[model samples]
Target chain A: MTGLVSLFRRLEGPQTLGRGPAFWALFALVLAGALAYPLFSDGYTVGNTVYFFVWVFIALSLSLIWGYGGSLSFGQTAFFGIAGYGYGILTINFGAAYGFTWIALLLAIGMAALVAALLGYFMFFGRIAGVFLGIVTLAVTLMLERFMAQTAGPEWRIGAARLNGFNGMSAMPPLTIPWFGGPIPLFADVGLYYVVLAMLVLVYLGLRILMNSSFGNVIVAIRENPERAEMLGYDIRKYQLITFVIGAALAGLSGVLYTVWGQYITPSSMGMTAASLPLIWVAVGGRSDLTATVIGTLVVLSGFQALTIYGSQYALVFMGVLLVLTVLIAPNGLVLGVIKGITKLVTRRKQEAA
Target chain B: MALLQLRDVNKHFGGLHVTNSVNLVLEQGEIHCLIGPNGAGKSTLFRLILGEHHPGSGQIYFAGEDITTLKSFARIRRGLSVKFQVPGVFKGLSVRQNLEIALQSRLHGAALDKEIDRLLAFLNLEAEQAQLAGNLSHGQKQWLEIGMAIALKPRLLLLDEPTAGMSPEETHMTGEMVRRLNAAGMTVLAIEHDMAFVRQVAQRVTVLHLGQVFAQGSIDEIVADERVAAIYLGQAHA
Candidate 1:
């Protein structure tokens, strides 16, 4: 247990850790909870666990851009919706077959990245500030929503046999592992759960690498003080655009995975409500630490699931209260505050010993 | 030939002319100080040189090339660097990481680390190399800003009130560091209100009042000028 604590502590960084034994114990408990869910849970519970992992990917992407890059976006859902629809349209409507579906996913991510580049180019270059950036992104979400709504009409609608308008696209084929001879049955919820778990691990490792690279340092520096970064000979807009695109691509990947899990893609997923979830996850998880974001997602989603089962409408009220309290009392988020408190307690103990 | 030259630079906000046709020349390896009363457009002229703001009507030449329309980042890439009146180090980055970013702008691959280490030792920031920049003292922040400007060994460094909020000892230390940098063959243009510090280090001085050059000469010449003294007193004694 001590060795495991040390490993996670090393991963978290000295700036993020506490020196207290109590804090380590609590951290260990949380890690055990996260790792044990898939192992002991039934198929239905594991399916929800898979859903949470997919959301974790989305939350991580948001944490990178909004939390680290300091660019608040309300257009992330557009990337998710677009990519999901792109995959569905390519595979189902066009009958592009199996290997081509993977290619389609990549193309969807690239398209989403290109859109982010275009949006970031306009916003950062134009020097749009604060609420104006919010408004611009909100406007983009509304525009995409309107475009998807209109697709139900004559111009682009593939009829009731296709897109299905607000009803969403469904009946996506299950992902196949060609090495295993044929497609993994989508009905095998446990199998899908493991696949999602592997993807989440891979995505987490990839993000960790990107965040530690020289390019990631540039992104964080830009977040801290863009003017200073520019004075230091960095092309601030270029970095902003690149970070935005990378973040958008990550969202696209999550969206593709989400469609696979739910086997559906709806226009509502591209709306403001869905867009805001990832931001909330980043805020609750703590912006500075990526692992905190995953924990935050698990905590919030678990609370949400529990509330829905017990008291349907009241669950949303509980989340609202929790968000307000977290913002007012622990604006740095729960994980960071807990770490700091533990560190202080440890320092106080060492002083007493001396 | 002058490394940088400004001719007939004018800036106006409403009816107020902040800079009125100010002319100046900065030769290679010279430390030029621009000093005047508050609201005399000293910092405004610095902004013009950095391309943060364009002059109403004027021309700026850098390395004998016209750079009147270049953006701030472009000018920085072209060997012009400015440290703000308020130190602008990224608060989240460690001292070494901050230096590394600056060094990366000029050097790539294997040489980056060596350059960063050399800069860390030169700026005396090796002790707190792992500390976040926000943890640094005011004087250290000022030095870090200067270190960032000199990262690529820029041909010209423009400092706006480098020691605006430092103790006497810290100010003295900053003055010594500026001298060391100047002696190392980098041209410096410092905007300072500290007459004593400017007198101690400046090779030349330019004085601006109500948006125009009130006087221009050595520090001794400007300080001793009768008209310059009256401008400092807010009296029309020209």
Candidate 2:
């Protein structure tokens, strides 16, 4: 894993640029591993892995928004929930047929983007940044949780869908896409896992390409220092708003996928623990590098689930200790922290040889 | 019409009047230096010009257009760009990437490479082109920032304290660069504390005190004014 991570880092640097025979080799190996997952794991295992991939998508969005875009959001789950509910309402009557599922997926992403744009317009244009942004976003998330939880009556139903209070909208049909066959359901456990994994990889690659573009350069510049970027004639607010929408779209996509996987959407998904999950994931991974963020999310999240499965009384304690250690020793996140140490060791060894 | 003008601009932060009916102008192709002590509102006036703060009451005209209500980026699009007190280069990026971003603002395609090279050469930062901007020394960072401001293809360049923490040699070089830019037909409006730098580059100087223009004249004329000595030079003699 460490060797592959180092290879990934090399690929990120401009010189490698994600090409070269070694990169292709690593890519093939990872592809083989992902494809052969069903051989080694059961349907339940694949399902949970898909579940984990859903969070990974959200984690990547957070990394982009906070890490590169410089907008720390504690409420990204708000957008995720927005999409979940939006998808549920849009596709509820059709039961994943008539291709409404695809339309609903797009609409869910669009709704999240539009909402994010509005939120960003208000927050950034008002010059509400830094910790203030986090506070505002968290407030939005908590507000959604409370708002959705209160819809206990039949009046809360949109079309055939119901905002079923804490029980959530259960038995929502699985999302199906236009395959070689007409509108095939992605409900099969292994198939759903692959779909989620493919989306994750695609989103990852898309964001990577974007960060290398001039647009990405400009936004990151705005992130580093808004005033400086402003003086240079870049509209800081515009960049922030645009990136906010993109991140929201990604989150919305993740939420849609999660709803499909879980077969239900809930108000508690945006509650305290769930809302803060990505924060721990990205922070533990390190926000500086995208690869680190993904790895960190997988490692910590899997460990967390393992602890829960064993019914360890110290599960929460263990999570806290891991986070605290990352904050102290790694600070950059465990992946990058470990990478940095490795690079230093290599350089020292080279020096000794010299 | 002046290249840049502020007429009857009034800005007050509650009781503290940061700008009081202040009127200033930078003529085309001239190096105009605004100089004052710490509380003289020099920076505030610069902000007002850069659209960082809108004047409470007044008009700002740039290149014969009313730009009083314009945003900072809009004002910049109108050919006004600024370099702040701190160096404004994108530190995480390479020096070339920093210049490339600025170059991209006005130029694109194959032209960008040539422009980036020209800017790097102009600022004598060609050697540091591949280095991270944050790793550059103070003088080089300032030069890189200046390079960025000019890369905007600004008709009027606003620089705040360009030589604040420079070595004397670097200060001289910066003064020379300012003169070179002015000669190249860029209207320069600079707020500076280095009197020697102002003497080297300024065609005309404006002195402000207590949020208002105290005097405006040729550098020598301002130096000859007794009030300027008592107020700006901190002399007891009047």
* Native contacts kept, each candidate: 0.78, 0.78
CA deviation > 4 Å runs, candidate 1: A1-42, A154-161, A185-188, A340-354, B107-127
DockQ of 2: 0.70
TM-score of chain B of 1: 0.95
Residues A1-354, candidate 2, lDDT per residue (tens digit)?
975553344335431124457656877898799889888999987877888888887898898889777789976899999999888888886677666787888998899999999998999889899999999999999999999999989899988988999889877778786666677787848878887778888877767767766677777777766777877778888888888889899889989988888879999998877788788889898786677788889888888988987775577778778878888887768876886687679779989999
Tens digits of lDDT, candidate 1, B171-227: 888888889989988899999998778977899998888878888899889878988
Tens-digit lDDT track of model 2 for B126-214 = 89999999999999999999999998889999899999899999999999998888888899999999999999999999998888898
Q: In order, what lDDT does every prediction score? A: 0.79, 0.84
Judge candidate 1 at residue A310 and give its lDDT.
88
Strongest candidate by lDDT: 2
A247 in model 2: Cα distance from truth in Å?
Answer: 0.9
What's the true lDDT of residue B75 in model 2? 90
Using DockQ as the measure, the top candidate is 1
